[model samples]
Target: MVRKFYPEEFKADAVELYSSTPGATIKKIAADLGVHEGTLSAWLRAAGVTTVPTAAGRADGGGAGVPETPAEELERLRVENKRLRADKSLLETEREILRKAAKYFAGETTW
Candidate 1:
């Protein structure tokens, strides 16, 4: 099998992303970048950086450090809640549209 080569710029950006976000893991970043975990590790080492243990995201409920301040945490939660509400609304709208479409196609609608 032929090996795929990623751009050096992409590898650099991936390393920068890993370095900038402590809550992000190599595996996660690699998956996001469509590269292998070992490939990311190699790039990191090439840059003289040692990969640390994986850090959990907020989804995991904790990570590799102290908790955020109460206000920060609250703001984060508020943002997340707003996003979830929007998602719920979108899903409801889609469901309603699908139901109407199904009824119309089945000759149950006046139109």
Candidate 2:
């Protein structure tokens, strides 16, 4: 395997991008920049950038150092709520299809 070298400016920019983008994961940002996640993490560490830890004891990219205003928080919640509802709807449909399949297969069985 060949090792690749990135310029100092590019590394700085990548770190900045990670810090500036809200809700952006290191994995996602690294993929976008065509670099390995570990490379990006190293850049972050070299730049002395620390991620904020969430209540779940995991580092989160959201709310880097600034707290969201009430309106921003509300908007974020609304978007999350919408996504969750869509997920729930899809799961319900899948469950119904599975239930129908099970019923059909059960009826077809004979001993």
Candidate 3:
């Protein structure tokens, strides 16, 4: 991976995001910015952005951060489910392609 650099203004905007957005976490915003959560967290502290931790805060396994609202959670699950199904579809397609390729190589496939 290449070392990344971010503009100070961008960092300031990101730091302010946590305070401005309800239920928004550092990890979530960082992922949206294509940066690491830890890097964003450090920026937050350096900028003196005080964040109040909620008891429900957690890191998302596949997404960004844990959803705070019921609607948010539902949306997150729906997105993840869609992504998983798409991945499954791709894998199935790839398997079919490989199976056909194998038959062709073995002289068992008809045009």
Best by lDDT: 2
Q: How well is each residue in 62-104 modelled by candidate 1, as lDDT tens digits?
A: 3565556777666566765775787899999999999999988
Provide TM-scores for the models: 0.48, 0.50, 0.47
lDDT of 1 at 60: 24
TM-score of 2: 0.50
Cα lDDT tens digits, model 3, 5-106, are 899999888887766765556667888888888898788889887654443454322444443787656665665577578789999999999999988898
**Each model's C-alpha lDDT?**
0.72, 0.76, 0.71
Best-to-worst order by TM-score is 2, 1, 3
The number of residue pairs in model 1 that clash at the backbone is 0
Ranking by lDDT: 2, 1, 3
Highest-scoring model, TM-score: 2
Superior candidate under TM-score, 1 versus 3: 1
Clashing pairs in 3: none
Q: What would the C-alpha RMSD of candidate 3 be, to one decimal place? A: 8.8
Off by over 4 Å in 2: 53-111
Q: Tens digit of lDDT per residue, candidate 2, span 17-77?
A: 9888655577678889999878998899899998543323334343344566677667666
